[model samples]
Target: MADYADITYAVAERIATVTLNRPEARNGYTIRMADELGDAMDRADRDEEVRVVVLTGAGRDFSVGADLSQGGFDFDPESGPDAAWQEPAGRCSKRIFTMHKPVIAALRGAAVGGGITITLSCDYRLAAEDARFGFVFTRRGIYPEGASAWFLPRLVGMGTALDWMISGRLVDAAEALSAGLVHRLYPADTVLEEAYALAREIIATTAPVSVAVTRQLLYRMASAPSPFPVHELDSRLIGGLGKSSDAVEGVVSFLQKRPPEFTMRVDRDLPDYLPWLHDSI
Candidate 1:
């Protein structure tokens, strides 16, 4: 519902779509865009009516990375005090990681550097047939930003992540899919449609709070040394949910062989343990 210069935000049918709106520079990423994206994501996460979010670009490209219109000086971190510096793309990616709503990236064209890194936190990436991707930091004589060193390896495995990040090569849609960078490939025009369809499907069938908790657990437990921690967290979440109104409806609907009308609001109904509260840096 808020206005953004570099992106558009809309919510319909419980889905909030955050679109990168800078098309002129192949939808180049910018500091303003990243701030806007993080703000939009926070809005979506707090809105109980929103169950899913779809991230995409407004024009031909998703993003070719940060706008360097001013010159390469923008990449000079030493020019600014380290404490005052914030990687714009990293802020957005962190927001995605923390959001309760599932986030899906819909890529149509070039997604390189900040473009690709920004999407690493998305639950899934659906790209178009003509999409081109890269992690070109090495080629630019810079290291990866946006905490991509952590996200990239997790999503695509260390070997593949190293190859992609170290090589700094441009990859086509096929290679992206083969390398697990994206989950599905579709025609450019249909990528958004598919993303919307997927969102609707999830909204219709799943309990919102359950989905939120499950997403958190999966992401948090990935680096867990053993299943014991997960088991403990799972027990607390599941045990609490079993007594919920939504759970009752879920069971009743199943017995009656009908669709469930889930009523749990994420803001009001999410378990206390599921939240990972923190102070801002």
Candidate 2:
């Protein structure tokens, strides 16, 4: 709902579409754009009316990475080591990482460096057949931002992440799909619609609270040291299901052969006992 200069945020039919709006520059990533994207994603996460988020760009390209037209980043050395600092791309990626609502990235054309890293935290990445991805940090003589080293290996594999990041080669849509970097590829014009269709499917059949919990659970527990902790958490969640209205409705609707109309809202219904809700990951 807030006015954003770098990105456009709109909500309809329980889907929040957050768009990178600077098509003239290929939606070049900038500090202002990062801040605006973080704000927009946070807004969508908190709004109870929003069930899913679809992230895309305005024109042919998603983004060409950090804007260098002004001679790269403006770093203030005078701020010293004590200053609170976070990389521009990390600002957006970290927010998406913690969001309860499912975030789907619909990418087209170039999604390189910061552009591609920013979407690494999204739950699903749907790309256009023309989409191209590259880490390119090593080529630029810069380190990776957006905690990409942590998220990328999980999405793809360690070998793939190492190869891509180290080589800084552009990956095409088919290779990206084979490497599990993206969920599916579509024509450039239809990628966004495909993302929306997926969003609508989730909205129609899934309980918001369940989706929220499950989303976080998978992200938090996937790399867990042992299954015991996960088992314990699963037990707690299952034990509480008897009192869940959504659980009851899920069963009843299925029995009646009807579409479920789940009433549990993510903002209000997420369990307080969820460890990741309070713990920083």
**What would the per-residue lDDT of candidate 1 be over residues 1-281, giving only the tens digit for each residue?**
35789899999998999999988778888878888999999999998989899999988999999787734334555666366667788999988998889999999989999999999999989999999999999999988998899998888799998888899999999988988889999999999999999999998889998788788787878888999988887888777865799899999999999989998888887777653644252
Could you give candidate 2's per-residue lDDT for residues 251-271 as a string of tens digits? 999999999989888777888
For each candidate, give its TM-score against the true structure: 0.94, 0.96
Clashing pairs in 1: none
Candidate 2 runs further than 4 Å off: 70-74, 78-82
Best by TM-score: 2
Alpha-carbon deviation at 158 in model 2, angstroms: 0.6
Task: Give the clashing pairs for model 2.
Answer: none
* lDDT accuracy of residue 256 in candidate 1: 97
